[model samples]
Target: MSAAREMLCDTARAVFAEAAEAGMAPVEAAGFDLLLVPEADGGFGGDWGDANAVLRIAGVAVPDLPVAERILSGLGDAPKTLHAAATVGLMAGAMGQALALSIEHVNTRQQFGRPLGKFQAVQQSLAVLACEVAAVDAAAAAMAARLDAAGLDAEAADFEIAAAKLRANRAVGIVTAVAHQVHGAIGFTREYDLHRVTIPLMRWRGLHGNDAYWAERLGRQVAGFGGRGLWETLTARAE
Candidate 1:
C-alpha cells in the first residue's frame, strides 16, 4: 500500500476500533459517512479506493449502522444500496473478524488436555477458512485497484466487479460454515460477537447481485463477445 493509503486505512481502523469498543452504532460513528464524498460536495472527497479500506474496517467492527450503503449512496448514482465491491469488502471485513475469533477460540479452548487448535481436524478447517478470507480480500483489492485506475464510470470494470462480488458471495458460505464449525456451539449463541459478522455476511451475500445473478450476467457478457471477440472483449477497455 502507498503511504497515503496506509495512513487512510490506519485512520479508518482507529475510528472503527473506537466505535466497536464504545458500542456506537455504525451510522453514529462520526466522519465515516463522509469518506467517499468529494470535498467540493461538502465531504471528505476520498474516492472508491479509500472507501474500500473503510468498508473493510467497518466490516470487522460490524457496527449496527449501514456504513457500506451510506458510502455507496454518497459516492454514486446507486439508490443507497451496497454495491458489489462494497459488499465484497464488507464480507472480507467480517471474515477477518471471524478468523481472528476462531483462532483465539481454538488456542484458548481445550479438549482432551490440549488446545483445540492442536487438533488436526481443527487445523485443516482453520486453514480452509484462512484461504477463503484471503481469496475474498484479494478479489476485493483487485476490483478496488481497477476502479481507482479506470475511473468508476468505466464499463471495463464491470467484469472485475461482478467477479469479485461473485467470489465473495461464494466464499461467504464456506467461510461462515468453517467459522461456525470452528467455534462450535458458541458461535450460534447471541451472547457471542461472532454472530455480528456472520449474520451480516449472510445477509450481504444476497444483496447487490448474488452469486447466481452475477454468474448469469458474466456468462451473458462473455457470450455476447463470441469466439472471435472473446480475447479482446476480456482485455477491452471502455472508450
Candidate 2:
C-alpha cells in the first residue's frame, strides 16, 4: 500500500479499536460530516475516497455498524437500492456466518465420538473461510485506495464498488451454506446465532443491488465506455 493509504488504514484501525473496546455507538452522520467538510469548514477537506477509507476501516474493526450508508451518500442519489448495495455488509455478514458455523461445528457433530471439526474436510472449509474474510479485508482496502487516488472516474468507481459488494454478496451465500452444511441440521435452528448472520446476509444481499443487479450495472458501464472519456481526463490532469 502507498504511504497515504497505509496511514488512513492505520488511523481507521485505531479509531475502530477504541470504539470496540469502549462499546461505543457508531456516530454515522458525525463521522461522515467530519470527513466530508472542507478544510475551511474545519473539515478534513477530504472527499469520497477518504470517507470510503474510514468506512472500510470501520468495517474491519466493527462490521455490525451501517458504515455502508455513509459511503453510499458520496455517490449521491443513484438509487436507494443501489446505495444499499454499496456496503461491505455482505462481507461482514459472511465473516459472522463463518465464525458462527466454526463455533457450532467444533461443539457438535461426531467422528469417532469427536467433533466433526477434527476431520480434514472441516478443517479445509475453515481454512477457506479464513481466506474469504481476508479477501474482503483486502478488497475493501484496495477500493479505498483507488477512491483516494482520484485515478478512478466517478462512474467507474461506483461500478467497482458495486463489483466488490457483488462479490461479497455471493461469498456470503457460499460461506453461509458451507457453514450450515458443516453444522448440519442444528445450524438451521433459530436458537443458534448462525441465523443472526445468515438473516442479515439475506437482507444485505438484496439491499443495494443483489448479485444480478450489480452484474448488470457493471456490464452496462463497461459497454458504455468507448475509450477516451474519464480515463483520459484522469490521465491528462497533473498529479
Candidate 3:
C-alpha cells in the first residue's frame, strides 16, 4: 500500500474503533464517503483499491456505518446498497476482526492450567480460521483491482466480482463458525464485541448476492462459454 493509503486506513480504523467502543450509531466518518469520488466531482479521486481499504477497515471496526456502500456508490445518484465489491470488502473486514479477537482470546483464556492457544485443537481451529480470513481478504482485493482495471468491461468485472463475492460468502460461514467456536459461549453474548462483527458478516453475505446466487451466475457464465472457449474466456483481459 502507498503511504497515503496506509494513513487513510489508519485514520479510518481509529475513528471506527472509537465509535464501536462508544456504542454509537454507525454514522459516516468524516471524508470517508469521498474516497471513491472523482476529483472532478470534488471528491478524493480514489480507485476501487482505496475504497477496498476503507471497507476492510470498517469491517474490522464493526461500526454500523455504510462505509462500504458509500465508497462503492461514490455517493452518486445510484442506489446506496447491494454493491458487490463493497459487500465483499465488508465481509473481509469482519473476518479480519473476528480472527484478531479469536487469537487474543485463545492466547489469554485458559484451560487445563494453560492458555487455550496452547492446546493443539484450539491452535488448529484458529489456523483454519486465519486461512479463511486471509483468503477472503485476498479475493476482495483482487475483485477491487479487477473493477478498477476493467472499468466499463462488464463481462470481465462481473466474472471477478461474482467469484469474489462467492469466496467471501463461503469464508464468512467458516470464519463466523470458528470464531464463535473458539470464543465458546461468550461469543454469543451481547456484551462481547465479537457479535458485532459476526452478525454484520451474516447480514452482508445475504446482501448484494448470496453464495447460491453468485454460484449459479458463475456456473451459467462458464457453461455458456462452452468447453473450447472457456479457457480463453477466463484468461482474456478486459478490452
Against the true structure, what is each candidate's TM-score? 0.85, 0.62, 0.87
Runs in model 2 lying further than 4 Å from the true structure = 1-33, 36-39, 44-67, 70-86, 93-97, 100-111, 151-153, 223-239
For residues 123-143, write the lDDT of model 2, one tens digit per residue.
Answer: 888777777766765555555
* Cα lDDT tens digits for candidate 3, 1-239: 99988988888777777766664343354666777677999988877788788788777675476666555555565432227767788788888889999999999998889999999999999999999988887777767777788652445577778888889988888899999999999999999999989988888888877889999988888898899788886676333
lDDT per residue for candidate 1 within 1-239, as digits (tens), equals 76877887887777677666665453455666677766888987776778888788888775455777776666567631237677778788888899999999999999999999999999999999999999988888778877776666436577678778888888988989999998989999999989999899898889887789989977887788788787785465322
Model 1 spans with C-alpha error above 4 angstroms: 17-29, 39-43, 79-82, 226-239
Candidate 3 error regions (>4 Å):
18-29, 73-82, 152-155, 237-239
Q: Listing every candidate in turn, what is its Cα RMSD in Å to the true structure after a full C-alpha superposition?
A: 3.2, 5.9, 2.8
Candidate 2 TM-score, true structure as reference: 0.62
Comparing 2 with 3 on TM-score, the higher-scoring candidate is 3
Error of 1 at 92 (Å): 0.8
Which candidate has the highest TM-score of all?
3
- On the 0 to 100 scale, the lDDT of residue 66 in model 3 is 65
What would you estimate as the lDDT of candidate 1?
0.79
